[model samples]
Target: MQREPQVVEAKQQGGSKYRYRILAMLFVATTINYMDRSIIGVLGPTLIEHVFHWTKMEYAQINMVFKFAYALGMLGMGGVIDRFGTRIGYILAIGIWSVFGMLHALVQPAFGFIGFCMARAGLGFGEAGNFPAAVKTVAEWYPKKDRAFATGIFNAGSNIGAILAPLAIPLVVLPDGTNWQFAFLMTGAFSFIWVLVWIKIYKKPEEHPKVSQEELAYIQSDVEEGEIEQEKEKMSWAKVLPLKQTWAFAIGKITDAVWWFYLFWGSLFLHDQFGLDLHGLALPMIIVFLIADVGSIAGGYLPKIFLNRGASLNVARKLTLLICALFILPAMFVPYMSNQWYAVLLMAFAAGGHQAWSANLFTVASDTMPKKATASVVGIGGMIGALAGMLADFSLGSVLTASGKEGYVFAFAIAGSIYLVCLALIHLIIPKLERAKI
Candidate 1:
């Protein structure tokens, strides 16, 4: 009661320390969330040998089913997160996906292929909620200005999960080489640990007693002018959907799919090219992906460097993302490589570069949207991205596979170039990096 300004000042000085801890649980949740999804990619060859006797076309169809379901699911989940709060929506998402992840191992009948597809669909459906919920949570918990780095940290979870899979999936195998079941089960079960961590640790700014008033004030300081607008904007969905914020998110997400395409198909590309057996080429590629993990965290830190140089947030974010996107172009050379190690160097860095781009792109979505509607916008874009990814997958097996090795090189080139095209489209759609004028 002494003075309102003094209260805010005191809290700001102390409260900044707590933000990382608050975000740490979200980081782990994202890690486990993606870990569950990626297990299949790593276990693909084993699953074919042990479980379903899948033909190539049949396997493609199986993926198509999951993609279709996941696309629809993403559309629905984003809207739901808009209406509901982040915590509850996130819990529901993780709950269903994790359960199905384990169930992938339990299904029987060699011809019960549809059941496996359905389970994959369930995993896709559940995971659809991940980004929308996570983006929303970031929008809710962090001020607008700080979101990019935070988003980068959470998005890096994909890399972390992908990195771990080579070791984890192989470790749980049976001697006879039939035990892909334990890999799925163990990965799925890992999500529950994050659930416990998230439930205990997460809360809104005002709701957390440990969050001092000063800290909240500083957290809100850059965003103080919009706190009322951000809070008021949360009232409903219709008002939020009509603005440029919607497009900003959609474009960024569509671009995001390009990276996912690289990750989902990368090892397969190696296997296809090198006649990779699990122990040789695939292991090296996994090591490469694991090595790429550094780029995720590094991507976020780049803009902070710009900020120290006194660039505005808007300027710093765009410059950093554009630079990251540009790094992807060199990746087109992978298919041309006669040497496998050179191929590894090119592809891993390119994928890592994409993560760096991805880490900043999400910040752009938050940069352009008010907190209230961030989930819906992210959902729509992510939905489109996933759908586009499905098409890309089809193209990979069908079009890219046709030319043999050169086709593969061209495929990597196409993949590399997508981010810059995405960035150009982003510039056309909403040139300035600010919240939309709606």
Candidate 2:
């Protein structure tokens, strides 16, 4: 039998706990990233009704600009991180996004909607770097067995960010939407603090003085699964883009549009259907994302349960994804509910399910691809997901303009059903989650 790594023993035995610090930083970064992007969403209804007075189509166009920029950023940022390493790559990303995020305050009414789109596009591009750097960081610091859980822990930050938006934004922006610009400025400023700490604290696991031999061994235990043949060489998209494994990962990400819808439009839905104002929207929105936070952590943990029970990695990952998809099926009924809280409950399940699904879906890349290529593959998948979001935004914008509240039925139905289809397609693309030859 293979010997267990000494780091698995109790910390009193001198096991180093430095990797958890890395995970914590990732969690904070993700939280700030989501907070920066989600500010617009939390302020959307107010902006549309009281401030910008934008039509549904115009609002959709603004979102489309962000998605388009995000899609392009994903394509490039993945390659940049893969080439430069996560440390510098992450700094560059956060720096760009923070500047643009704060610039939202500068968008004058004279510049009109075009100004907001410009700021959002910059924010989108910078925010695109987040997952690529984060996933690559996880792959560097944790073995495959722990990666999903680590991912889930950090991924939960998205929900926390979403939760914080309604709670905090209401405090910054008045009920009538005065001082709305402060919301973006305040949230965007957080990264400067994070960057200072990150610069001092971060280094490769092997190189970091705080990471002990036993802990380093623990981190490297599964390295052979995704062999690092050219550990120092940069991965080219030419190498990974052609693989079925890459497509499997990308296709699985098509459901990201659903998650984006929840983040960007869920509050609006609540406002329109249930007549909830900023404060009234808080409790339901908080309830929805808090449940999602649980799902994110649980989603990462569930596969470990299956793994311990003697299931194959392929089976554990796919089965967990299946459970998550089933949880989302109730979303179709969200638009039909007579009670607002009932609708909130159902929306919570769908949001939670998506977070769970996202946690596993992210691990699929590192599970199958080389560690060097993790960011690149994740970037490719994110780009595809962003493109999918753009398409959804276009459809939603046009439909809501023409049909008003009725558009939600179509939206919920798609969100409820697409997961199973994508899951089916993922299975068809990669029958087993074997490591890619690349």
Best by TM-score: 2
Candidate 1, which segments miss by more than 4 Å at Cα? 1-13, 49-51, 174-177, 224-242, 400-407
* Tens digits of lDDT, candidate 1, 1-438: 133544656656655556778677667777777677777666555555556666544555666666777787777787777677777788888888889888887777554587888888898888888888887777766665467778878877777777677767666774234777777787655677767776776777667777777666656665646554555444344665667657665666665555655555666667677756445544665766665676777887789789868898777987887888888788877887878788888878887787788778777777777676677777777777777777766766565435544556556767778778777777777667766654
* TM-score computed on alpha carbons, candidate 2: 0.97
In angstroms, give how far residue 259 of model 2 lies from its true place: 0.6
- Evaluated with lDDT, which candidate comes out highest? 2
The all-Cα superposition gives candidate 1 an RMSD in Å to the true structure of: 3.1
Question: Each candidate's lDDT (Cα)?
Answer: 0.71, 0.90
Backbone clashes in model 1, listed as residue pairs = 11-214, 11-215, 12-214, 12-215, 335-409
Q: Which ten residues in a row have the lowest lDDT in candidate 1?
A: 228-237
TM-scores for all candidates: the values are: 0.90, 0.97
